[model samples]
Target: MTKTKKPEFRPNDFVVYPAHGVGKILSIEEQVIAGMSLELFVISFEKDKMTLRVPTNRATEIGMRSLSSPDVVMKALETLKGKARVKRAMWSRRAQEYEQKINSGDLMAIAEVVRDLHRADDQREQSYSERQLYEAALERLTREVAAVSGVDEAGAQKKVDEVLVGRAA
Candidate 1:
C-alpha cells in the first residue's frame, strides 16, 4: 500500500467531533494492535484536557470534520439573531430535543438552542435544566465561533451575546 499521504487534515489542523465539539489534530500515526498495524488520528481537546485517537479510515464515519468555513461561520452567527422558536411540547420532551441539537455538533442547531433558552433580563427566569442546557450550547457555540473568527472564547462570547441582545431588543 502507498505510504499514508497527508490525509484529510494535517497536524495542527482543527477539527470538530460530533460528540466532543472541537479538537485539534495533534498527529497521525500507526499503532500495532492484535498483530495488525492500525492508523489513527490523534486528536486533542484542549478546553476539556482530553486526547483521543480515532482510526484514520473511520474519521468521517465518526463525524470528524474540518472546521466550518468563514461563510458557514457567519451563517451560524446569523442564526443567533433569529427569533426564538420554542416548541409547544412538554418541558421534558423539549429538553431532549435541545440536547440532541446541541450534541449534533451543527452550529445552527446549537444556535437555536441558545436562542430558545435565552432569557432576557425582563423575561421569566429559566429552570435549572434550561439554564444548564443553555450554557452548554453557549459554550459549544463560543468555542467554534472563537476558532473560526480567530478570537478568544471570551471575545467570541461577547459577539454572540451582542447578537442575542440585539435580537431581544
Candidate 2:
C-alpha cells in the first residue's frame, strides 16, 4: 500500500471536491475512529449548505484539488463556444455520462456537458432529466469560474450565457 502523504492545504483555502463543486477548508482536525486517531480536513460547501470531513491523506486520492488557473478557465469558456456533440446513444446513457462529467471535478469535462446539452432559443426543448443534468453542469462550471475569476455567481452565469449565445467577450 502506498503511504498516505500529508495534503498541502490550510483553513479558508478554496478547494474542489470531485463530488462537491467548490468548498472552503474550515479547519484540520483529528478524531478517533475505531480506536485510531485520524487526521481530517473539514470542508464546507456554502452553496450547498453542507459540510464534509475527509481524511487529509485521502484528499489527493479522492480528487480534491486547488482551483483551476486562469488559462484553464479561459479554455473551458472557449469550449462553451464550440458546437454541441450529442452522441447517438440513448438519453439514459447520455444522461449518465453527463452526470459523471458534472461530478468529475474537471472543468473541461463539465464545460463539454454544458456545451452539448445547451438549448438555443430556436432549438427544441430538452427532457426533464436533460434539463437537470445541464443545470448541474452549468452550476458546477459557473462556481469554478466564479471562484477562479473572482466574480459573483450571477456575473459568472452571465459570462457563461454570453459565450453560449456567441457573444463572448
Q: What lDDT tens digits, residue by residue, belong to model 2 across residues 17-129?
A: 99989999999999999998888999999989999999998899899999999999999999998889999999889999999998899999999999999998788988899
What's the TM for model 2?
A: 0.95
lDDT to native, each model: 0.88, 0.92
lDDT of 1: 0.88
Weakest ten-residue segment in model 2 by summed lDDT: 1-10
Model 1 agreement with the true structure over 95-159: per-residue lDDT tens digits: 99999998888888988899889989999999999999999999988899999889999999999
Where does candidate 1 clash, by residue pair?
Answer: none
Compute the lDDT of residue 65 as modeled in candidate 1: 82
**For model 1, the run of ten residues with the poorest summed lDDT:** 1-10
Off by over 4 Å in 2: 1-3, 167-169
